[model samples]
Target: MAAFTDSDGTCLFNLNDGKRELVNGAEAAQALVDKALAGRDHTAITRICLSNKSYDEGAAGAIAEALSKMTSVTEADISDVIAGRPEDMALRVLAAICGGLAGRSLSLIDVSDNAMGEKGVNACRAALEGQRETLSALRMCNDGLSASAMEAVRDLLVAGDVPTRLTQLHFFNNMSGDGGAKALAQILPHCPQLRDLRFSGTRAGRPGSVAVANALAACPAATSGRFVSLDLADNTFGTEGAAALATVLRKQANLTLLSLRDGSLEDEGMVAVANALRGAAPALRSLDLSANDCTGACAKAVARAVASCTKLEYLGLEENDGFGSAGAVKLAGVLGGLKQLQRLQLGQCSIGTRGAVALAKSLEGLDCLTSLELNGNAISEEGMYGFTEALGAAGKLSALGEMDDNNAEASEEEEEEESEEESGDEAEAEEETEEAAADASVDELTAALGGVKM
Candidate 1:
């Protein structure tokens, strides 16, 4: 770890020892905090990281007493604390105490990787509301937030005396469903400064996805090109959701990264999204559409769209088994235009001998190309030989992800396993979606959307 102090009074008090130190009891936690803060000015601390620890109420109270004195602290990372009732209660006590601090205002608060549920949200409400004037980012990933808990968050955002100055909100891998999505949509317009929004793996389907897209389409930040990164991966967007999202994407000129991986955007949905990218999102640096069931036609559309994105550094089109050698050749045709492309992920897209050869030829023009992932693409010995020779001649390729198992002889078994895995994944995803939907009722979503157009 680097020294905490800087010239500008921005200091970090990091207590995260890469999960090596176990500060379990109150005495241990107090001793650790005292030692870490020794010889340091409490009022000058700007950040505190206490991730991956164990604490009871007494330990949390001691930590809170220290935090209360650090009035300048703006960022707090209390993620991955030990999971249990005592730890949860400790977290609540810590948050409540911090919330009561008279002059403290946080800019970023991350409580990710904790199974705190609704009680955790309630405990943090005061702290969140207290910083409505300065809080910028809130990350609560994998926190077991349900639809009602999400609604509680929305209420907190609006209940403050002034609208929150939030710029980033990450709520990934929760069971929020459509109700939670609708709740978020209701609050999007209030967060005019929001730029980075990540709501991936929330089991949101078409209705939820469409609601969010419609909200973004009307959001002032999104319309004014202030939005930059949007990640909605691991959800079931399907065609309708993709179409809705496409409309939003067309308007995001300042967007840099767009991730819609594993969203079930089949050929039709992918084509819609690709068309939206055409002559749009010129500032995009990374675009991920992996496992989207794209084929040669989708690949052609993406190639045409990305040909104009000369600044693109990463393009991930992996796991789309329908994207065969033909698609690879189509993409290769436009590789010459993407001079800035460094990492290209084409793993398991069925790019065989002919496509590998074409890509090898195209590699000659990419001076910046470093990493190329072609794993399980069925490239035979001859194709690998030519590709390796091309890589050696280019001298820019350093990290090549390919194995002997990718050869033709083992490709059949690999493809079969891949197909079976894909089927199983889809079935599991469907069940999860259904379970989430059951948890959140239709009336709840409708009420959350009250008068909001979607």
Candidate 2:
């Protein structure tokens, strides 16, 4: 089933398979054209996807010819046609063909995952200008766009006589730094309908991030609480940028997903973001703040923010090694309230024995949790046992999907050494007492978990 007509009139043509059947672009284009022609109602094809295929200039022109005949294709996903190869000319031909469609008013254009550089942007300039009025979603991720290319995009938007109806814009993994970010920021106000914005892995630093955040704040959609999702992960948004984004977040009452992973937002910045998320984004469901260098110091604030988002389904706080036992305990206190949470990733946060026990206790309340990743948290065998017991007692062990890779088991020699130390000194006796207390707490937690009404 390489090609099929969706129920919503979307003609999806996928040629990405283990075996590359069509040797050249012309063959692929011919096959696509044949598929389209064979459809029950070719004229009703409102969307065409030629993604993950390779094409040359001539084949692109042939595909364009096919598209021109379709007449009803308002959305075209010509992304990844060259498959990471440099096919600037083919892209230009296809983009120009889309722009030249006499009767078509394209609303969505995705050219992502192609090695289209400045030349490709120049080629698509006409198409973007042609579809400016009706273009609602533009995705150009991983296209190797530079700052200069981004400037060209800004110019295209600026030249539009009226505001573009761009509701979603994804420019991920581009080499456009602060200059490009600022360029887009300067023209973002012209895109009043923009809502979903993804600029992750764009090499954007503090200045770029702050500029974008400020621009989003001033956008009509943001002011009216119409923004849906914002993904700025894998960028360098230090304290200043995080603070600026915090300000924008405060106004996003309707925003759903917010991802800022590996953004260099340390404890201070995360605390600021956590504070902003307290009551601002009530509709938020997916939040990713992993690898932000956050410590236990910010866990309380993060917990508060997480508690407020009652509808949250996914929470990723992985790779922050500073969130030790204390942080995990604080976070555990709030996990019970998130009844809608489906996936919770807390891997590599240094949440050791006691923290693991606390988290095990919270599992009884997470009726919807399907995946819980706590790998590399240094949880001991006792903690792991407690977790297994808790889950089994709650009758959710079968429903739980994934819980693996925790370094919990201790070697027999290590256990023997601990036993020897426990019999040696007064200090060892005190340590033994603390261990007993921890064991007692785990038992108490298990008992409490057994009583919870599932």
For residues 1-454, what per-residue lDDT tens digits would candidate 2 score against the true structure?
A: 1232466534553344434433256666677677545664656667776665666666777776766667676777766666634565666655645554545788888877766777788776655666777889888899888888888888766764478889999989998888878877877788778789888888877888788877877777777777799998987878888887887788889989999999899999999999999868879999999999999888878877886787899999999999866677767666776789888888889766656656666668678888877777766776667666766775556644344666667443443444333233223323433543465478689989999999
Instruction: Report lDDT per candidate.
Output: 0.75, 0.74
Residue range 280-391, candidate 1, lDDT tens digits: 8889999999999888767667776777577899999999987876677767767766789989999988776656666666667787788889887877665567677776
Q: Candidate 2, residue 50: CA error in Å?
A: 1.7
lDDT at 127 for candidate 2? 54
